[model samples]
Target: MPMPKTIGHQIHFAKTLSGLIRRGWWEIPEIMASSCMAAIGIVLGIVGVYNYEKRNGDNKEYKSVYMIMRPDDPRVCLLNNPVYTQYKRF
Candidate 1:
Protein backbone atom coordinates (compact mmCIF):
# COMPACT_ATOMS: atom_id res chain seq x y z
CA MET A 1 0.00 0.00 0.00
CA PRO A 2 3.00 2.38 -0.55
CA MET A 3 2.55 5.58 -2.50
CA PRO A 4 4.04 5.96 -5.98
CA LYS A 5 6.52 8.62 -4.78
CA THR A 6 7.78 6.35 -1.97
CA ILE A 7 8.20 3.46 -4.40
CA GLY A 8 10.24 5.68 -6.75
CA HIS A 9 12.48 6.80 -3.90
CA GLN A 10 13.04 3.22 -2.78
CA ILE A 11 14.02 2.19 -6.32
CA HIS A 12 16.49 5.05 -6.61
CA PHE A 13 18.08 4.21 -3.23
CA ALA A 14 18.43 0.52 -4.18
CA LYS A 15 20.13 1.36 -7.47
CA THR A 16 22.69 3.67 -5.83
CA LEU A 17 23.41 1.17 -3.05
CA SER A 18 23.96 -1.63 -5.57
CA GLY A 19 26.32 0.57 -7.60
CA LEU A 20 28.43 1.41 -4.55
CA ILE A 21 28.64 -2.25 -3.55
CA ARG A 22 29.75 -3.20 -7.05
CA ARG A 23 32.56 -0.64 -6.96
CA GLY A 24 33.72 -1.72 -3.50
CA TRP A 25 33.82 -5.40 -4.57
CA TRP A 26 36.72 -4.72 -6.93
CA GLU A 27 38.96 -3.27 -4.15
CA ILE A 28 38.46 -6.11 -1.64
CA PRO A 29 41.88 -7.65 -2.25
CA GLU A 30 43.75 -4.36 -1.83
CA ILE A 31 41.84 -3.64 1.38
CA MET A 32 42.68 -7.08 2.79
CA ALA A 33 46.41 -6.74 1.93
CA SER A 34 46.64 -3.34 3.56
CA SER A 35 44.94 -4.63 6.70
CA CYS A 36 47.36 -7.59 6.92
CA MET A 37 50.43 -5.38 6.47
CA ALA A 38 49.20 -3.00 9.20
CA ALA A 39 48.69 -5.94 11.57
CA ILE A 40 52.22 -7.26 10.86
CA GLY A 41 53.74 -3.86 11.47
CA ILE A 42 51.96 -3.60 14.84
CA VAL A 43 53.23 -7.04 15.92
CA LEU A 44 56.82 -6.22 14.91
CA GLY A 45 56.72 -2.95 16.84
CA ILE A 46 55.49 -4.73 19.98
CA VAL A 47 58.24 -7.36 19.78
CA GLY A 48 60.94 -4.71 19.43
CA VAL A 49 59.68 -2.76 22.46
CA TYR A 50 59.43 -5.90 24.64
CA ASN A 51 62.85 -7.37 23.81
CA TYR A 52 64.78 -4.07 24.11
CA GLU A 53 66.67 -3.29 27.37
CA LYS A 54 69.09 -0.45 28.17
CA ARG A 55 70.80 -0.14 31.57
CA ASN A 56 72.98 2.67 32.96
CA GLY A 57 75.61 0.33 34.43
CA ASP A 58 77.05 -2.84 32.92
CA ASN A 59 76.57 -4.82 36.16
CA LYS A 60 73.21 -3.31 37.02
CA GLU A 61 69.85 -5.00 36.38
CA TYR A 62 68.32 -4.01 33.06
CA LYS A 63 66.17 -0.88 33.08
CA SER A 64 63.75 0.06 30.31
CA VAL A 65 65.29 1.13 27.01
CA TYR A 66 63.38 4.39 27.16
CA MET A 67 64.37 5.31 30.75
CA ILE A 68 67.69 6.92 29.79
CA MET A 69 66.23 9.02 27.01
CA ARG A 70 62.92 9.97 28.67
CA PRO A 71 63.45 9.99 32.41
CA ASP A 72 60.62 12.44 33.14
CA ASP A 73 58.15 10.50 31.03
CA PRO A 74 55.79 8.79 33.45
CA ARG A 75 54.50 6.53 30.66
CA VAL A 76 57.89 4.75 30.68
CA CYS A 77 59.69 2.93 33.52
CA LEU A 78 61.31 4.82 36.43
CA LEU A 79 63.77 2.92 38.62
CA ASN A 80 66.31 4.36 41.14
CA ASN A 81 69.09 3.61 38.59
CA PRO A 82 71.45 6.46 37.68
CA VAL A 83 71.41 7.93 34.20
CA TYR A 84 75.18 7.47 33.61
CA THR A 85 76.53 5.12 36.26
CA GLN A 86 78.88 3.19 33.95
CA TYR A 87 80.74 6.17 32.41
CA LYS A 88 83.98 7.28 34.16
CA ARG A 89 84.54 11.02 34.74
CA PHE A 90 87.53 12.57 32.94
Candidate 2:
Protein backbone atom coordinates (compact mmCIF):
# COMPACT_ATOMS: atom_id res chain seq x y z
CA MET A 1 0.00 0.00 0.00
CA PRO A 2 1.21 3.54 -0.81
CA MET A 3 2.00 5.70 2.18
CA PRO A 4 -0.04 8.91 2.70
CA LYS A 5 1.70 12.02 1.25
CA THR A 6 2.00 13.80 4.63
CA ILE A 7 3.34 10.67 6.25
CA GLY A 8 5.92 10.25 3.47
CA HIS A 9 7.09 13.80 3.96
CA GLN A 10 7.35 13.34 7.69
CA ILE A 11 9.34 10.15 7.28
CA HIS A 12 11.72 11.83 4.87
CA PHE A 13 12.23 14.74 7.25
CA ALA A 14 12.89 12.40 10.13
CA LYS A 15 15.43 10.46 8.09
CA THR A 16 17.20 13.67 7.05
CA LEU A 17 17.30 14.94 10.62
CA SER A 18 18.59 11.63 11.87
CA GLY A 19 21.30 11.59 9.24
CA LEU A 20 22.35 15.09 10.19
CA ILE A 21 22.44 14.25 13.89
CA ARG A 22 24.46 11.11 13.24
CA ARG A 23 26.95 12.98 11.01
CA GLY A 24 26.05 10.69 8.16
CA TRP A 25 25.09 13.12 5.42
CA TRP A 26 27.36 16.11 4.96
CA GLU A 27 24.99 18.39 3.03
CA ILE A 28 25.62 21.03 0.40
CA PRO A 29 26.30 23.86 2.86
CA GLU A 30 29.17 22.01 4.53
CA ILE A 31 30.66 21.01 1.20
CA MET A 32 30.40 24.58 -0.10
CA ALA A 33 32.00 26.02 3.04
CA SER A 34 34.97 23.63 2.87
CA SER A 35 35.47 24.22 -0.85
CA CYS A 36 35.28 27.98 -0.37
CA MET A 37 37.97 27.91 2.31
CA ALA A 38 40.20 25.71 0.14
CA ALA A 39 39.71 28.09 -2.79
CA ILE A 40 40.63 31.11 -0.68
CA GLY A 41 43.73 29.34 0.61
CA ILE A 42 44.76 28.42 -2.94
CA VAL A 43 44.30 32.01 -4.13
CA LEU A 44 46.33 33.39 -1.26
CA GLY A 45 49.07 30.83 -1.89
CA ILE A 46 49.20 31.82 -5.58
CA VAL A 47 49.37 35.50 -4.67
CA GLY A 48 52.21 34.78 -2.28
CA VAL A 49 54.12 32.88 -4.98
CA TYR A 50 53.56 35.68 -7.50
CA ASN A 51 54.71 38.32 -5.07
CA TYR A 52 57.82 36.30 -4.23
CA GLU A 53 58.67 35.93 -7.94
CA LYS A 54 58.09 39.60 -8.61
CA ARG A 55 60.30 40.66 -5.70
CA ASN A 56 63.26 38.41 -6.59
CA GLY A 57 63.05 37.77 -10.35
CA ASP A 58 65.56 40.43 -11.37
CA ASN A 59 68.48 39.76 -9.05
CA LYS A 60 69.64 36.16 -9.26
CA GLU A 61 73.34 36.67 -8.58
CA TYR A 62 74.60 37.53 -5.11
CA LYS A 63 78.21 38.27 -6.09
CA SER A 64 79.60 41.72 -5.34
CA VAL A 65 82.86 43.29 -6.62
CA TYR A 66 83.18 46.24 -4.24
CA MET A 67 85.47 46.30 -1.20
CA ILE A 68 84.07 47.46 2.12
CA MET A 69 85.61 50.47 3.84
CA ARG A 70 85.11 52.37 7.09
CA PRO A 71 82.48 55.12 7.10
CA ASP A 72 85.17 57.55 8.42
CA ASP A 73 87.03 57.35 5.11
CA PRO A 74 87.72 60.88 3.85
CA ARG A 75 86.64 59.99 0.32
CA VAL A 76 83.74 57.58 -0.31
CA CYS A 77 84.55 54.80 -2.70
CA LEU A 78 81.99 54.91 -5.47
CA LEU A 79 81.37 51.42 -6.82
CA ASN A 80 82.32 51.73 -10.48
CA ASN A 81 81.47 48.14 -11.37
CA PRO A 82 79.23 48.19 -14.45
CA VAL A 83 76.67 45.79 -12.99
CA TYR A 84 76.54 47.75 -9.76
CA THR A 85 76.25 51.08 -11.63
CA GLN A 86 73.43 49.86 -13.83
CA TYR A 87 71.41 48.53 -10.89
CA LYS A 88 72.09 51.55 -8.62
CA ARG A 89 69.37 53.66 -10.27
CA PHE A 90 66.82 50.90 -9.71
Candidate 3:
Protein backbone atom coordinates (compact mmCIF):
# COMPACT_ATOMS: atom_id res chain seq x y z
CA MET A 1 0.00 0.00 0.00
CA PRO A 2 1.12 3.57 -0.72
CA MET A 3 1.82 5.86 2.22
CA PRO A 4 -0.62 8.77 2.56
CA LYS A 5 0.69 12.35 2.66
CA THR A 6 -0.30 14.93 5.28
CA ILE A 7 -0.79 18.71 4.87
CA GLY A 8 2.74 19.36 6.15
CA HIS A 9 4.20 17.04 3.50
CA GLN A 10 2.29 18.84 0.73
CA ILE A 11 3.46 22.25 1.99
CA HIS A 12 7.04 21.11 2.11
CA PHE A 13 6.83 19.71 -1.40
CA ALA A 14 5.43 23.00 -2.70
CA LYS A 15 8.12 25.01 -0.92
CA THR A 16 10.90 22.83 -2.36
CA LEU A 17 9.51 23.13 -5.89
CA SER A 18 9.29 26.90 -5.54
CA GLY A 19 12.87 27.10 -4.35
CA LEU A 20 14.08 25.02 -7.31
CA ILE A 21 12.25 27.29 -9.73
CA ARG A 22 13.63 30.40 -8.09
CA ARG A 23 17.19 29.14 -8.32
CA GLY A 24 17.07 27.45 -11.80
CA TRP A 25 14.73 29.33 -14.13
CA TRP A 26 17.24 29.72 -16.98
CA GLU A 27 15.26 27.47 -19.36
CA ILE A 28 12.29 29.85 -19.26
CA PRO A 29 14.32 32.79 -20.61
CA GLU A 30 16.06 30.53 -23.14
CA ILE A 31 12.73 29.39 -24.58
CA MET A 32 11.45 32.98 -24.77
CA ALA A 33 14.61 34.24 -26.51
CA SER A 34 14.52 31.41 -29.09
CA SER A 35 10.89 32.07 -29.90
CA CYS A 36 11.56 35.80 -30.30
CA MET A 37 14.50 35.15 -32.61
CA ALA A 38 12.39 32.80 -34.78
CA ALA A 39 9.68 35.43 -35.06
CA ILE A 40 12.21 38.07 -36.06
CA GLY A 41 13.61 35.74 -38.70
CA ILE A 42 10.16 35.17 -40.20
CA VAL A 43 9.41 38.91 -40.35
CA LEU A 44 12.71 39.65 -42.02
CA GLY A 45 12.11 36.94 -44.65
CA ILE A 46 8.70 38.41 -45.52
CA VAL A 47 10.14 41.91 -45.82
CA GLY A 48 12.88 40.66 -48.10
CA VAL A 49 10.39 38.95 -50.41
CA TYR A 50 8.08 41.97 -50.47
CA ASN A 51 10.86 44.40 -51.39
CA TYR A 52 12.24 42.12 -54.11
CA GLU A 53 12.19 43.47 -57.71
CA LYS A 54 11.33 46.99 -56.69
CA ARG A 55 12.04 48.44 -60.18
CA ASN A 56 10.07 47.43 -63.29
CA GLY A 57 12.93 47.87 -65.73
CA ASP A 58 13.25 44.18 -66.55
CA ASN A 59 9.72 43.18 -65.67
CA LYS A 60 7.79 42.82 -68.93
CA GLU A 61 4.09 42.31 -69.54
CA TYR A 62 3.27 39.08 -71.37
CA LYS A 63 0.96 40.62 -74.03
CA SER A 64 0.17 44.18 -72.87
CA VAL A 65 2.36 46.66 -74.77
CA TYR A 66 1.66 49.40 -72.24
CA MET A 67 1.32 49.00 -68.50
CA ILE A 68 -1.95 50.07 -66.83
CA MET A 69 -0.43 53.10 -65.12
CA ARG A 70 -3.65 55.19 -65.15
CA PRO A 71 -7.39 54.60 -65.00
CA ASP A 72 -7.65 55.20 -68.76
CA ASP A 73 -4.98 52.64 -69.71
CA PRO A 74 -6.21 49.78 -71.92
CA ARG A 75 -7.14 46.63 -70.03
CA VAL A 76 -8.29 44.34 -72.84
CA CYS A 77 -4.70 43.46 -73.74
CA LEU A 78 -3.68 42.99 -70.07
CA LEU A 79 -6.67 40.85 -69.12
CA ASN A 80 -5.02 37.46 -69.72
CA ASN A 81 -1.41 38.63 -69.24
CA PRO A 82 0.14 37.41 -65.98
CA VAL A 83 3.07 39.83 -66.16
CA TYR A 84 0.82 42.91 -66.14
CA THR A 85 1.08 43.20 -62.38
CA GLN A 86 4.87 43.06 -62.49
CA TYR A 87 5.04 45.51 -65.38
CA LYS A 88 3.84 48.36 -63.20
CA ARG A 89 6.52 50.03 -61.09
CA PHE A 90 4.14 50.76 -58.27
Candidate 4:
Protein backbone atom coordinates (compact mmCIF):
# COMPACT_ATOMS: atom_id res chain seq x y z
CA MET A 1 0.00 0.00 0.00
CA PRO A 2 1.16 3.56 -0.72
CA MET A 3 2.09 5.81 2.17
CA PRO A 4 -0.28 8.54 3.28
CA LYS A 5 0.16 11.89 1.43
CA THR A 6 1.02 13.93 4.56
CA ILE A 7 3.67 11.52 5.84
CA GLY A 8 5.14 11.10 2.34
CA HIS A 9 5.51 14.84 1.85
CA GLN A 10 7.15 15.27 5.26
CA ILE A 11 9.61 12.48 4.50
CA HIS A 12 10.49 14.01 1.14
CA PHE A 13 11.18 17.40 2.67
CA ALA A 14 13.33 15.89 5.41
CA LYS A 15 15.38 13.96 2.86
CA THR A 16 16.03 17.08 0.81
CA LEU A 17 17.13 19.01 3.91
CA SER A 18 19.33 16.16 5.07
CA GLY A 19 21.00 15.84 1.66
CA LEU A 20 21.79 19.52 1.54
CA ILE A 21 23.12 19.60 5.10
CA ARG A 22 25.28 16.49 4.58
CA ARG A 23 26.69 17.70 1.24
CA GLY A 24 28.20 21.03 2.36
CA TRP A 25 25.74 22.46 -0.12
CA TRP A 26 26.80 26.05 0.44
CA GLU A 27 30.23 25.18 -0.96
CA ILE A 28 28.76 24.77 -4.43
CA PRO A 29 30.97 27.10 -6.48
CA GLU A 30 28.11 29.12 -7.94
CA ILE A 31 26.54 29.61 -4.51
CA MET A 32 29.86 30.29 -2.80
CA ALA A 33 30.93 32.80 -5.41
CA SER A 34 27.66 34.72 -5.17
CA SER A 35 27.60 34.45 -1.36
CA CYS A 36 31.16 35.71 -0.88
CA MET A 37 30.87 38.39 -3.57
CA ALA A 38 29.24 40.89 -1.22
CA ALA A 39 31.75 40.25 1.58
CA ILE A 40 34.66 40.49 -0.88
CA GLY A 41 33.25 43.76 -2.23
CA ILE A 42 33.03 45.14 1.32
CA VAL A 43 36.59 44.10 2.16
CA LEU A 44 37.93 45.66 -1.02
CA GLY A 45 36.03 48.85 -0.27
CA ILE A 46 37.52 48.95 3.24
CA VAL A 47 41.01 48.43 1.85
CA GLY A 48 40.48 51.22 -0.68
CA VAL A 49 39.22 53.58 2.03
CA TYR A 50 42.13 52.72 4.34
CA ASN A 51 44.66 53.27 1.57
CA TYR A 52 43.04 56.57 0.61
CA GLU A 53 42.99 57.78 4.19
CA LYS A 54 46.61 56.70 4.79
CA ARG A 55 47.74 58.60 1.73
CA ASN A 56 45.63 61.73 2.32
CA GLY A 57 45.91 61.75 6.13
CA ASP A 58 44.02 64.19 8.42
CA ASN A 59 43.38 66.95 5.91
CA LYS A 60 39.60 67.17 5.91
CA GLU A 61 39.50 69.74 3.15
CA TYR A 62 37.33 68.88 0.21
CA LYS A 63 37.19 71.09 -2.87
CA SER A 64 34.51 70.86 -5.51
CA VAL A 65 33.35 73.02 -8.39
CA TYR A 66 29.66 73.64 -8.86
CA MET A 67 28.79 74.74 -12.37
CA ILE A 68 25.72 76.83 -12.85
CA MET A 69 24.02 77.10 -16.21
CA ARG A 70 22.60 80.51 -16.99
CA PRO A 71 20.32 81.14 -19.97
CA ASP A 72 22.40 84.27 -20.69
CA ASP A 73 25.69 82.34 -20.30
CA PRO A 74 26.65 81.62 -23.91
CA ARG A 75 28.76 78.62 -22.78
CA VAL A 76 25.54 76.55 -22.80
CA CYS A 77 25.86 76.43 -26.59
CA LEU A 78 28.67 73.96 -25.76
CA LEU A 79 31.16 75.28 -28.35
CA ASN A 80 33.16 76.17 -25.20
CA ASN A 81 33.00 72.57 -23.89
CA PRO A 82 36.27 70.68 -23.30
CA VAL A 83 35.22 68.16 -25.96
CA TYR A 84 35.38 70.88 -28.61
CA THR A 85 38.72 72.14 -27.26
CA GLN A 86 40.15 68.61 -27.81
CA TYR A 87 39.29 68.83 -31.52
CA LYS A 88 41.58 71.85 -31.93
CA ARG A 89 43.96 73.86 -29.79
CA PHE A 90 41.97 76.46 -27.80
Against the hidden true structure, what lDDT does model 1 obtain? 0.56
- Local accuracy of candidate 2 as per-residue lDDT tens digits, 38-83: 9999999999989977765534334465456676774343324434
For model 4, state the Cα shift of residue 23 in Å. 3.0
Deviation (Å) of 10 in candidate 1: 26
In candidate 4, what are the lDDT values of residues 16-36, reduced to their tens digit? 766765444434667756757
TM-score of each: 0.32, 0.37, 0.32, 0.33
Candidate 3, residue 14: how far the Cα is off, in Å: 20
Candidate 4 clashes between residue pairs 3 or more apart in a chain or in different chains: none
Task: Write down the TM-score for model 1.
Answer: 0.32
Candidate with the greatest TM-score versus the true structure: 2
lDDT of candidates 1 onward, in order? 0.56, 0.58, 0.58, 0.58
* Model 4 lDDT at residue 29: 60
Q: What are the per-residue Cα lDDT tens digits for candidate 3 across 1-90?
A: 999766542322235876656444443767667877999999998877777645432454454565546646664543444544543466
Structure candidate 2, residue pairs in collision: none
RMSD, every candidate, angstroms: 12.4, 11.0, 11.1, 13.8
Cα lDDT of model 4 overall? 0.58
Error of 2 at 82 (Å): 12
